[model samples]
Target chain A: MRVLGVDPGLTRCGVGVVEGVAGRPLRMVGVGVVRTPADADVADRLVLIERGIEQWLDEHRPEYVAVERVFSQHNVRTVMGTAQASAVAMLCAARRGLPVALHTPSEVKAAVTGSGRADKAQVGAMVTRLLRLDAPPRPADAADALALAICHIWRAPATNRLQELAAAHRRTPTPVRIPKGTR
Target chain B: MRVLGVDPGLTRCGVGVVEGVAGRPLRMVGVGVVRTPADADVADRLVLIERGIEQWLDEHRPEYVAVERVFSQHNVRTVMGTAQASAVAMLCAARRGLPVALHTPSEVKAAVTGSGRADKAQVGAMVTRLLRLDAPPRPADAADALALAICHIWRAPATNRLQELAAAHRRTPTPVRIPKGTR
Candidate 1:
């Protein structure tokens, strides 16, 4: 599965495309950051982000898009910006009917480094090694984007199974027992 | 000046359009809510918001789009959704190259009711009074949206002056000072 991972931010949105399924070698197709001027209005900045993400979608045409799930508790100052940027990214993917998945920061870190608390350097190291890259992607955000893509590719199988099981359970209706007295 | 105001929310996004300048009477062109199913995916919800906002823009073609500024300090649980919804609203306006203004909740309340701490009912009542409506718009969100538009219209003059002053200051470069010894 080819997935485009987005590490959403207002100032600098990191994007990376990775292709592979679980239990297979992953290949990095592209990596870059979509930057917006800090001095620009938030609305104008969102328009720029939309254009940037659209360019990436046009070029990569990934089957799925993975975005970092934003939590309001992360950074009090920039949480709003992060959430806004993520919204633009998700909107772009969903507009094209592409499935979008959100991975928590820790989930991406754990998927790549085997530790949810792994630092940036650790994630960078793992992404480089896993993708057989000559060096880790620049600007920690870029590496994190790749990590998100890797996480989605690796976890999709299990997620699908769980979803299937839940669906099956819902499909099976509960049987109602008739009381002898009521009957 | 005509303004389209948006009260962004995931489940129900309220929108209203008001046409008038700061001093004169304002006219309510339209008022409604764009709703998405609670069970819908966030990405799909955003797309629905985008479409809804686009339709409003297409129908009204307001000179300015006014959106409530989302603060992270607000309801922690729903703040993220609010931010995301606001982003989509801004994106729709900015894509059309329309000027977008964000009014704080207090600002909107104060503009209509003369008190920043006014309750929803107060704001709604004032909005109905200001617009000469038969009754307050249905749904608190819808009334709040009209209040936002009213705020933008009332505040635009001062905001423009401030922005003009700031721009003029930027244009006027600071003179370099040379000490006698240096000279």
Candidate 2:
């Protein structure tokens, strides 16, 4: 399966696409960074992000999307911005009817570098090593994005059997409870 | 002087411009929302934000720009987004040689509602009341943007004077001391 991984940011976003399947090595399809002009307004910056993602999606047409989930909650303003960016990613995948998998930063690092606390430089090195590239990915964001894709490939289940079991449980009927007063 | 206030986001950004001098009643010169398609990429979203800000600057020629400073410590992803968005605003102002001011969320809310802990609804209500508007601004982001302008107007002296002092300090030379070990 082809997977599109995204590292979302307002000014710069890193996107990577990789093709692979279970028990198979993943191959990099494309990787790039989207940059917003420093002088642009917030509105324009957001537009830049959207256009970049669209271009990437059109070129790759990946079957699955893997995005980093927002886990920090320190600054309200920061949290709001992240929420908006995450919402955009979700909307993009949902619009295309592509299944999305959200991965935590630690999980991604752990899968790629064998350590949950791997720094950006370490992660980048590991990605370069794993991809067997001559150099590390330019723009740390892109490397992180690639790592995210590799992470999902390593961790996500091949089949939706677990999901099906959960869904079946959810679909099971519940017996009505009689209120004490009514009884 | 005209001051433009911005509340940056990935999906929607709120922008407002107020025309007046310090201590004078500011009039709303322009206000609007810039939106990005949910399915679009991050780069495209940023472009939209830039275009919206550029359009507003071209139309209004505001002398100064004010933006909210994002300060998230927990969520790295969210913090990165906010930092990117904030960088865009700063760059826009710098490009036009307009001085930019950043206010914290609590500071803006405190200035608008006399309470740092004010909620969005409370801040919105207070902004409407302060502006003598018949209805509250639609989409909380817009109201917050307007509030940021109001805060800048009311607290301009504090910020301006501090900036002046900092500039003066930078210009003044300090005595250099040689370390005893070096000597």
Candidate 3:
């Protein structure tokens, strides 16, 4: 399945698309960054980002969208902006009825390098090697987007299986029986 | 000017519209809450919220949209959700070409109740009095939204002046002089 991976940020949001299924060769469909000037108004920056992502969505038409899940960040301002951008990505995917998956940084790192503590250099190197590119994408964010897409393609089956199991459990809930007792 | 104020949250978002200029009586054009189930998926909830805010913008056609600026909260999850919702409000306003303003909670309280530390009850009472409503609106969120509207109407002029001054300064930047000996 084709997947669009979004590394959402206020000043520079990374967009990458990868197409493949598990145990199959993966191909990089596209890679780019949507940038807004640091001095621009927040609302205006978001509008630009919305337009950029919309354009990417229209061009790529990926079956699934993967976004980096934002954790509680020490810098509140930074985290808030990142979270807002992440939600914008989700909204774009939802508008098109495409299922969206959120992968944490550590999760993506582990899936790509087989280690959760992989550094940016290592992650970038792996992305370059895996995607068979001549050079690692610049500014880390772009490579990170590709990594997120590759991670989702490789790991999503497991997550989907778990979700299916949970849904089945919900459909036919837990059974309870009373102990036999004298009338 | 007419203002649509939004107090954004995940479970229940407050929205209110008020119209008036400085030194004039403010009228509450609308006040209500948009709700989503607490258990709903985050993406789904956000979609619902986007639709709700879009509808409000379409119906009210306010000149300005004001959102409560989210501060750093102890609960990261809660704050992130609020930030996401607030961004949605801003995005809707930006899409419609309506200018957006973000007011801090303390700022709204100070504008409405003459005290930055004013409690919700006091803010609600003042909002009721200011809008000449028959009674204080139900659910503190709705009242807070109206308070935000009033605050934006009352406070925006000064803020606009400051921004204008900054922009004007930028247009014709400060002159630099070098000492005769230094050159």
If both were scored by TM-score, which would come out higher, candidate 1 or candidate 2?
A: 1
Q: Write the per-residue lDDT of candidate 2 for residues B95-144, one digit (tens) a residue.
A: 67788888999999999888999999999898788777778888998888
TM-score of each: 0.91, 0.55, 0.91
DockQ of 1: 0.77
Off-target runs (Cα >4 Å) in candidate 2 are A1-183, B71-87, B118-134, B174-183
**Clash totals for all models, in order?**
0, 39, 0
Residue pairs that clash (backbone atoms under 3 angstroms), model 3: none
Interface Cα RMSD for all candidates? 0.7, 8.6, 0.9
DockQ of predictions, in order shown? 0.77, 0.07, 0.59
Which is better, 1 or 2, measured by DockQ? 1
**On residues B1-183, what C-alpha lDDT tens digit does candidate 1 reach at each position?**
899999999999999999999889889999999999987789999999999999999999999999999987768869999999999999999999888889999989888888999999899899999999999998999999999999999999998788689779879989989888985
TM-score for candidate 2, please give it. Answer: 0.55
- Candidate 2: TM of chain A? 0.84
> Model 3 misses residue B78 by how many Å?
0.1
Query: Candidate 3, residues A1-183: lDDT per residue as tens digits?
Result: 999999999999999999999898899999999998999778877888899999999999999899999987658889989988888888888878888889999999999999999999999999999999999998889999999999999998997788678768778956777678933
**How far does residue A137 in candidate 3 sit from its true spot (Å)?**
0.7
